[model samples]
Target: MYTYVLFVHLVAAVMGLGAAFGFPIVAKSAKTVSQAKFVLNLLHKLEVLPKAGSILLLISGIVMGLLETWLFKEVWFIGSIVIYLAVQFIVAGMLPKNMKKQLAALEGVQGEELPEAYLVLGRQSAKLEGISHLAAFVLILLMVFKPF
Candidate 1:
């Protein structure tokens, strides 16, 4: 039960991160509006992952740590989930809002070149990417170490 739950948790983390990865690819391509199709596809892929993988991962992980064993006594496992959730919250809040801003700008421009504001948003997105990637690494450590 422990190992199985761990496996599900890890897999969910992967899915969530992978979904977020679409933003960099999409945002980078946003500079070239003509090539936004690939980015759009990536965004579509990302949109589907969390709804599916997140639930499974959360359920299995909670079962293992909260109920199956006293794993919560371990700081690493607990910390990892906390960090993961925080990262998810930032991603959910930051990225989509940025995208929506860009989308609104697009509506104004009617699909013309991206504005200066959009570029600034893209730059900020790079920062978000770095933070989320680091969070993912910490989660990996928590899973492996399960440290108290």
Candidate 2:
């Protein structure tokens, strides 16, 4: 049972965190306002991967801790939970708001080049995305190594 839960947790991490890493690249690839809007819309749709994966990973992780009993007391586990919650908070809270602002900034524009406001917001969002990815990597390390 623990093995199965662990497998699910790992798979969820890959599905969610893996998809998240692509967001910055995708956001950067847009050459025009329409293209940017389309790409951002696609990103919004793709968010399901991370959202569902994170939720599942959280549930499965808790189940594993309950089953194993010692995991709850481990530093690695506790640290991973803290980082995971932080990443989720950033992903769920920060990214969407940033994206919405970017979109709103673009809403009135009509051109191939994005407005300065949109570009500035895009850079900020990209930075946050990079930070989120870093947090995900740290969580992965903690999970794999279980280092105290």
Candidate 3:
């Protein structure tokens, strides 16, 4: 049972975290406003994969911890949970709002050239997304090493 739950957790992490790492690459490759909008729209549509993975991770993690009964006592486990929740808050709260800002900045703009406002918002969103990815990497390290 533990192994099964752990497997599910690992798969979820790979699915969600892997998708996250791709965002910057896609966002950075946009050469025009239409391209940027298409990328963002595609990202929005594909968000469900990560979101589903996140939900599975939470459920399986809690079950494993409950079965082992070390959720509160283990430092590494506690840290992972905190980091996971923080990442969730950023993903659910910050990222969407940032996306909206980017979209709003691009609104009514047309041409092969991009506007400064859109570029600025894109940079900001990229930074936030980068941080989230970094945090996710940290969480993965913690889970794998259990250094605490």
Candidate 4:
């Protein structure tokens, strides 16, 4: 039923967005080169949760829209969908690329201090992550308030 679908959607959002919101904090905890490398590798592995959650989110959201039918015509619903897709693009396409660059930049570094190249890439990744977080916040607002 609708309630069950809504439940699944909410769970997916939590699983996906919760991991996303935690990423910056996790990444920021690295103080040494080894820590940074370990964190990045761990983050890469942790990406699977959000990826799976995102897929479930999209599927459940579409099913709910189909069930309701009227939601398709709502401004808030449309806006949420748009924002969701944008976040997806950033998460799926941009973030991984940036992470890979960060990892590569860490290669051949010979000190405890983080290199400038890795720092630069980390900053870029953080900015992208910030944008995605903002988009996600807006998406949540739209969903919760339905402020059309």
The TM-score leader among the candidates is 4
Give lDDT tens digits, candidate 1, residues 1-148.
6777777877886786676655576557555544543464467566678656666776887888766567777777678678867987766678667666655544545564666766676677678887977877777676777666
- Residue pairs clashing in model 1 are none
Per-structure clash totals for the candidates: 0, 0, 0, 0
Candidate ranking (TM-score, best to worst): 4, 2, 3, 1
* Clashes, model 3: 0
**What's the TM-score of each model vs. the native?**
0.80, 0.96, 0.94, 0.97
lDDT score for residue 85 of model 1: 77
The collision pairs in model 2 are none
Note the residue pairs that clash in candidate 4.
none
> How many Å off is the CA of 65 in candidate 1?
0.7
Model 2 alpha-carbon drift over 4 Å, by segment: none
CA lDDT of every candidate = 0.68, 0.89, 0.85, 0.92
Q: What is the lDDT of residue 110 in candidate 4?
A: 93
Models ranked on lDDT: 4, 2, 3, 1
lDDT of 3 by residue, 3-122 (tens): 999999989988887887787788788888889888888888878878988999999999999889966688999998899998888887888787777777778886668788878878
User: What are the RMSDs of all candidates, in order?
Assistant: 2.6, 0.9, 1.2, 0.8
